[model samples]
Target chain A: MEFWVNRDCFYKAISDVSRAVSAKTSIPILTGIQIIATEEKLTLVGSNSDIFIESNIPMTINNEKILDIFEPGSVIISAKYLIEIVKKLPNDVHVKMNGRQLVTIKSDDIITTLNGFQADDYPKLPRIDEDASVRLSNTELKELINQTTFAVSKNENKPVLTGVYLSFQEKQLTLAATNSHRLAIRKLFIEAYLDGACIVPGTSLNELSKLMQDESGHIHIYITESYITFKSVNMTLYSRLIEGNYPNVLGLLPKDAKTVITIKTSQLLKGIDRASLFAYEGKNNRINIEIEDGSKMRISSNSSEVGKIEELQNIKEINGQRDLNIAFDGRFLMDALKAIKEEEIQLSFGGSMRPVLIEPIGNPNYLHLISPVRTY
Target chain B: MEFWVNRDCFYKAISDVSRAVSAKTSIPILTGIQIIATEEKLTLVGSNSDIFIESNIPMTINNEKILDIFEPGSVIISAKYLIEIVKKLPNDVHVKMNGRQLVTIKSDDIITTLNGFQADDYPKLPRIDEDASVRLSNTELKELINQTTFAVSKNENKPVLTGVYLSFQEKQLTLAATNSHRLAIRKLFIEAYLDGACIVPGTSLNELSKLMQDESGHIHIYITESYITFKSVNMTLYSRLIEGNYPNVLGLLPKDAKTVITIKTSQLLKGIDRASLFAYEGKNNRINIEIEDGSKMRISSNSSEVGKIEELQNIKEINGQRDLNIAFDGRFLMDALKAIKEEEIQLSFGGSMRPVLIEPIGNPNYLHLISPVRTY
Candidate 1:
């Protein structure tokens, strides 16, 4: 393979794909990035068992030539060394490969020769059908991922709960995740009516979110037999689908509400944060909270080894007449509070032992449920 | 005991002193920060076995009031908890200590009661004589620390090698550190005529450098029998002196050079950095450099497992007729290159097997000596 490409574009493509590469993979070849140079473009791919990311550099960008291909071929070089070398090289970069799979990377002043594997030895990406795909905005998809993934179970015992459940019907797409102790659900409307459901690892969604953080425009989501791909203009991300049934998260909600309190999101978030600092050091990061109808709320956590903290903040509004007191994992409450994008949120309680529902005061599209810690 | 202080000033003081506190200390009380409120100022102190830092917040700054002390007393609270609480508190903070050592930390909205120990239980900082102290600019003192400390040996086999040696005579205060393979020496003039020498741990110098990163003005260096103190306005750092005879490093250098090369500091630094990236993965991070009279320099490193790198750059000037080829640790070269203040540097080699001297051209204040690796 012999090719020359703009250093900045190549650097960006390599860095973006490098996120999918893991240095500790069991498969040795998987730790390297595959570089393919065709007559029209250069494709850079990095992958592990869980994820594969590909970024393409077109031959020319806006009339300026970014790539000049002398020979159309491919090679796989160690991602760790390739990235470090490419980061330091200056100006336009030229690459050439020898018969022994020794690739020499050169810039204006530095020449780095790296040992690479033959392209034929690399693992090929599975075929994905573009017809069975739904297009959605990057912003809306990012919201869905962020709102629910934190509730995904970290315990490996239940593999399905470690992934986010996506349910699409008609024009509404719903995403839900639960860890038995807490559940988060978000619903959004999309123009694409392709109805489908799949469970994707929460880790994949997080990586996808980061990929789209600087990206705008639309992203096409394609679900195949065993994999799902999020493709954009010049970048594509493929993640393995968890082959198990997701829990019925909607059925886990409490039926009714005994009392509801409305408070500013910042106040509650800050209060819970301070309380959890001391609470998290204890057994379960537990905090006791009490609220009455149209009155100030009290949040407190005590640790025998550490000290105790009591924070008081006024309530914006409250419903129901009965005063209520409950104990919960403050960390769970804080996570839900942070996920909320609104300035104010409402807290709805079923009972001392039942799950509490937290929702933004005006937005009906998102909600979180937390099971109260049972205290004797 | 009770006091009210401005949150920003108090926070800065605590943050500065907290650098000396270690959470993993053997003595439990050492993990806490001692706060002593006097009629005129509030003193915060944190210490580990190696270092102690104290910062004092006066009652007033310029013309504005920063502190109001209702009573004079002292308490020691967990640095971890105290820092977190103080970071989140808003506006001014009010601190009150009860007879039971249960301190109430309060702001307008948040209240935290932390368990504390008697201030007398906290380890006391060793006193250094102020009369036998040298005054130096923060910038110069910081430069001396940065230039010489990197050569200190990380291995604790010889405890003295882990510390930087200081020699004071006449108006010049010389700092030297060597790890057998490499040595860095820096000398500068100070106003105070305190003729004494002491060895301070490289770790302590690094911490001291960070403390002065944003600070300006002069700092006082006090040398007593057992301790060395670097004190500026409102802040004081105390470090235990290492007691041992340093190796005679001057006797290790050769009298004359067989060949010499002059090159841009940045160019040589960058070349070594790129070579070291591939070299570091191998056994000794070894790189071979060759130079003759008025010829371009070539820097190369090869690894059988990885590949090889050859970087060539034009030479500005050269002296001596004989050609020289030498191998040295690239990391050591990079560290000395980074410490150099001049754009042009002179590299003088005595022979292929002798120590190489690197010094900034036209500057007699600092120089680095690196022993060449003898490869068969």
Candidate 2:
């Protein structure tokens, strides 16, 4: 496309879309970013089979000229090479598309002509019905994704478990992810009414979280049976939905706890991390947690080859008269504590061999469950 | 060893010595650090085949207690694991020799026992005559290493070229390194007597540079036929010297030049970096430099698949009435420019195909020679 654009604006658009571009893709065209320059805006799209990211640079931003479109056309250029070229170009760059898919980008005294693919060879972005959309603030969505995405299964054997199960019911949205070893669940309130369930790839949700920078504005999400689209001010990301039913993880969490303890999140996290140093040398980084007199807790881990560590951390509040000793992966506990923003956290222990429910103090909306390890 | 040391002192000592520890070493004892606790100081030594680093933590520093030695003993503990343990340990730790080869490290409520290697199994530090020693500031030594070490050949075919040639004469110390394609030479005036030439491995020199830190105190260096040792306040690093004679690089530099150009080092570096982005797409990342009218220069590079870039850079002065155009590796030029601390750099061109000499504007001590690529 023949266009002149500011270096910063063009570079940002290319970088955002290039995230979806795969250099080792079997399909050659998938390695390139499709650029469409129109009279109103210039759109860049990049995609692999799983997800697609498209960013638009408007002709005018804040009443300032960003792009000058001399001719409305489209072309697909190598994502890697184009990004490098734009980053190295000095100041404003003028791009012109010649015949035979030859694109010329010129800066101060530098002119580079890169071979590009035909626009027709690139895959088309899916068309989603905007009417079926839900509006949520970027901040809320990012928080939701961060709190649960890490627990999603990375193994592709059970493809459905690799995606986060997002369920919506009358102004409330629940996000849940699990890899059998650990599970994370978070719920947030939204303004729109969206009563449906969709499975979004954890990878795509993580990328969406990074792209959603504006905290005040609401991001519009449109979901179909096979695809989902998240649209922001000048960005649109489309990702394919995993086709399968997510496992029911609601029952995995303990309903009745034998003992409950409330402790400072930072103190507990540091104790577990130190104990894990020795435990990690063993087969599994398993750390034992013993609650005494409801208000005192001791964390200990040991390895046959390495040494052992025992740390005593104070708890603020305790419930139930029974004492509990549970063993769980130290990494899971650390992740749960890190995700929690509150000063205090409540940990519910069912038994020594059962899953432990970790929740922010006085907040049940966000919960993490870790399966206890059999240290014996 | 039996001692109680502050966490900070223990952590620093472990980290400094751990640089020499290699997990993949064939020598099992080399994977651990030798800790010798004395009544006055605690010494930690770690070494692989190429180099050894030792850091000593004194019993007291600045009227503060850093180490309290209850018993004088020596033991070798896994450097990698010990460093991690000491860093994460809570508060001051008490380390002791529990048995013949068993070491116990205890913190507040954490206790870890690791199998320690016998002191007899560890290799002894090399002993060099202190009579033949040269003294130079740690800052100067570090600068010399950074300026020339990157040019050393990494190939083992010519093992001698993999080391930096260091020569001390009168009050001048010179360092030179070359990979056959390019050469880097740096020199500084010292307050020491004359010494013969020595070849220290570039890898070892790089490690020593990092350990030098921001200190300006003079470092004592001892050179022998087989090994070289650098001693600072409380640290000592010993490295094996490479055997063989170094090439005569002085004759390679042209005494007389037909063209000389003086330009801002940073401006030229930035221009070349941008041009290399396109040139890098080619086989050699070759960038062409042309000097016109002794005051203006043009830098350009082009790839058949990618585009081209050209920048007109301003030069302050040019000597001789000859226009020269030459092509060389952009990365090498960038390295030379980074090593130069002067604002302006002087480039002497012998011919279109001859090696170009890059030196400081008025200083002749440090010189870099880059071979030109013949373009058909």
Identify the leading candidate in terms of DockQ: 1
| Candidate 1 stretches greater than 4 Å from native | A292-294, B292-294
True interface contacts reproduced, per candidate: 0.78, 0.68
Q: What does candidate 2's lDDT look like per residue over B1-376, in tens digits?
A: 6899999988988998999999898888999999998888999999996798999999889999888999999999988778878888879989989667888888887777778888988888999788988888887789899999999998999998999999898888999999998999998988888769989999999999888875679799998879999999989999999999899987787888888888899989989988897778776779999986666798988877656667788888888855788898898999999889899998888888889889898777888999988766
Quote each prediction's TM-score: 0.98, 0.96
How accurate locally is residue A348 in candidate 2, as Cα lDDT from 0 to 100? 81
Clashes of each: 0, 2
Chain A TM-score, cand. 2: 0.97
List candidate 2 stretches off by more than 4 Å.
A213-216, A292-295, A321-323, B291-296, B321-323
Q: By TM-score, who's the top model here?
A: 1
lDDT of 1 by residue, B91-142 (tens): 7999999998999999987788999998888777888786788888899899
**In model 1, what is the error at residue A230, expressed in angstroms?**
0.5
Clash pairs, candidate 2, are: A112-B308, A113-B307
Q: Give the DockQ (2 decimals) of all models.
A: 0.79, 0.61
